[model samples]
Target chain A: MLQYSEKVLELFTNPKNVGTMDGDDPHVGTGVIGSPECGDVMQLQILVDDQGVIQDAKFKTFGCGSAIASSSLATEWLKGKTLDEAMAIQNVHLAEELELPPVKKHCSVLAEDAIKAAIEDFQKKLEGRTDKAELHSPRCCEKLNDCEGCGSHGE
Target chain B: MKLPIYMDYNATTPVDPRVFEAMKPWFCEDFGNAASRSHVFGWKAETAVAESRETIANLLGASPQEIVFTSGATESDNLAIKGICEMYAPDGGHIITCMTEHKAVLDTCKYLETKGYEVTYLKPDTEGRVSAQQVADEIREDTVLVTLMLANNETGAVHPIAEIGKVVREYRARLHSHLFFHTDATQGISKIPFNVNEMAVDLLSFSSHKMYGPKGIGALYVRRRDPRVRLAIQTHGGGHERNMRSGTLNTPSIVGFAKACELAAAEMENNVAKLRHLRDHLEQGILQNVDYVKRNGHKTERLCNTANLSFGYIEGESLMLKLRDIAVSSGSACTSASLEPSFVLRAMDVPDILAHSSLRFSLGCYNDLAEIDYVVEKVATAVRELRELSPLYDMALRDNTTGDTDWAQAD
Candidate 1:
């Protein structure tokens, strides 16, 4: 049996905001990161306002318990923080907070990476609008093609 | 909640308090090398080792002279299988064994295959029980030895060794004129009755840790009458275990093992009865609560303490995660890294998906009825939840969540 941290086990058994959110909502910044080979996949959606402050966050994870718990904790920490503050959430810090063992620390790293990737996508979109307003108007949806939240490829 | 309820008894066991008490003195003031035959200090150590050897021999109904100690079951198995092969290398150059045997036996056979020797790997039925007739059928003109395990570690399927022994005896007279039989009875000594005479086996292996004793110690039983049951030493060192195994004997561990063997001989009947009852209770409870559950191995020939089940559409690892508080095993612990289903299940012809979705509960003497009931409920709930979330289940049922599948009820 894999030894789970008490906090991680608690979070896994009773995860918060376990379902999906509407990523199209204007108030949220959605983060979805996954590598196909590892099979550790997750979808994270954080709702944020014009002030760059996160309002709400939700996730749907499809991996081990540590992966689920790590993603859940990442979302909970994202709420009430600015985009820059949320970007600062490191995988090592989350691992320390959850008391994850060395092997499971990768899960926390994945969660941290997901948050950063999501924020980077949001920043790219905002920057594209300022660089070329007319070109960026209808291209926001087109930009989503490169950013696969959770990286799940539909058959 | 008692935090963790350990159910991986096959891996190892907690030392019994009685055995620990018996060994405490040997670690301190009584510590002396058993090999030293010069003075009073050596005499005491030799006496302790001899007495322990006698006590262990008594438990297995073998003479004290026939008992030879080794590191553990793995070493005992290696010494018994490889040792005999090396000794008879010039003569009967063949070995026979089943596919479901432990890695100790299987790997040894594989290594022997690389050497110049004929080997036959017999396959068992769906129940994992190897037939005695199968052994008789596989025997060749120059077959030297037949090494089979008394019971399987995963499914707890007891082989027909007694019947196999009868066949071996007949073949012994025809072929090499003295074919020896060996059994890795590591998981069978105390859990079940094992009389070498009744089984007619030349060599039998037993592990101390399997019966609530300390680790790193085990013994092999060699039938005294069989002069042809000779084996070459696998290692060269200071002569020990009549020069077959070489190492300064671990006196404290030997003493603990002896005491544990004695206790097991005295309490095995009661312990087995209790374990069997608790095992059945848990099995019945799970069947009553959960649907689509399939059992693996023989219905009646299964060990009294083990119950293996397959809950379709859900992986056992995910189910184990859900029921983290209950500490039961699922397939091979090593295979967890690759997430491959148990090879034992595959050998039994179980489908890959169903094999991955299996779990095993091996009850111990310390486990009570309450723990069994509690675990049953927890396991049922976890299996149900995992099944509900499984896309495979959804596809199999064609998205019909309300209509219950009859597969569970039939099983």
Candidate 2:
């Protein structure tokens, strides 16, 4: 078994705020990151108020134990924080807090990217932008997958 | 019973008390090299080794002379594949095997490939059985060996080795004549019914640890008559094991292996029935209670002690963590120190999501109905909990949560 921290195991077994929070609600900013191939797919949604403060955060992650723990921690950190404060939550910080091994650090990166993408989606609605907001850049190898003749891959 | 029950019997089984008792003498008072001909210790050790060899041979319906002891199934596999390839390399360098074989066989074939040998890895059907026709189609004049697994470790899909054996037998008599057949029956030997003559496998491999015997001991069945299959020796020392393999024999483990095989031969019928009862009950309960669950492998042809299931929308790693009371395996390669989904399930064309969601729960002689009940209840609960946390499952339940999101446009 992977050496998951106790907190990671606890949050995974009893993840907080797992269900969706009215995706149609204008105050909701939903961010879906990750892919099936990468073995992680996270959809994080935030409930923000007029003060630009996150009132509540909920998520659903389809991945391994660490991925679920990472997204769960992201949601827990998102609630009650100002948008700027939430933005400051880096993947590295999450990795350190979760004590995730280097191989699993990408799960934390997905969590952080989900935060940015969700915030951008909410701001896009606020600006009345009709075009869909671009989400996270696919991590490393998944990015170069579309290019031919370049077999070099990221870890 | 221990709180966290061991359900991963396919991985390795605990040594039976009888086997342990049989081995204790060899490890202590009877400790002597079988090759020592001058003393009573050597005679006693050789007697024990001969008896154990007879026991293993009896279980597989082969002669005692045909059984050559090795460290374990991995060594048996390496010895069989490489030995056969080396023996016939001057005449033929082509071998045929399947993709789902244990790494021992696959990696050995790969090493042979580096030495200018050709190998054909046949793909199994959805149920994980490589057909006899597939093997027959690949066999050629240069095909010196055909190595296939008798039972898959992950799915427990029992290949029709008898059918494949028939094909090889026909080819050996009518065509190539020198083409030999070997099977890594590491998962099959005592767990399922097997006879070397019926399977027509010239050489066969099996491990002791997988059959309630001690680890670090196994055997390779070599044909002695009817064309008399041959292999080049991999380990050259002491000129033991009929010049096929050379090393000081593991007397204790061999004795233990024989004891385990004797017990299995005596009790296999009843144990298999009990295991089947518990396995079927668990499979039915989990399937009836859980949602989007699919069973891998053949419905009836699988081993009675094995059950491989894919619980959709639930990550197998998370499920294993939550179902802590029942030890089992997941498709997550993290457990195996990798990140790839199970290649066995991938070969079956199970979707990536379900493949990652797969779990292998292998029942054993020690397991009872109560433990099966524990697994059925705990697994259903765990799957429900993980699916609740799963976004795809949640979105699947809620009709249009993703109506506006464009997945392809993310790039």
**Best model per TM-score:** 2
lDDT tens digits by residue: candidate 2, B1-411: 569899999999999999898889888799999999999999999999998899899999999999999999899999888888888775448999998888899889988898889999899888888889999999997888999998899999988999998999899888855788999999887778889998888999999999999999999999999768788889998989998889988899999999999998999899889989988888888877786777888878888888888876667787888887788998764444456678888887776666777899898889988888888889988888887888777656665544332111100
RMSD of 2: 5.0
lDDT tens per residue, model 1, B36-89:
899877789899999999999888778898998988889888999888888876
TM-score of 1: 0.77
True lDDT of residue B319, candidate 2: 81
RMSD of each: 8.1, 5.0
The global Cα lDDT (0 to 1) of model 2 is: 0.83
Clashes in model 1: which pairs? A27-A48, A28-A47, A28-A48, A32-A149, A32-A150, A33-A150, B292-B408
**Per-candidate TM-score against the hidden true structure:** 0.77, 0.94
Clashes of 1: 7
Q: What are the runs in model 1 whose C-alpha is more than 4 Å off?
A: A4-11, A15-155, B90-92, B332-335, B399-411
Per residue, candidate 1 scores C-alpha lDDT tens digits across A57-100 of 78765445777789889989998999989988888788888987
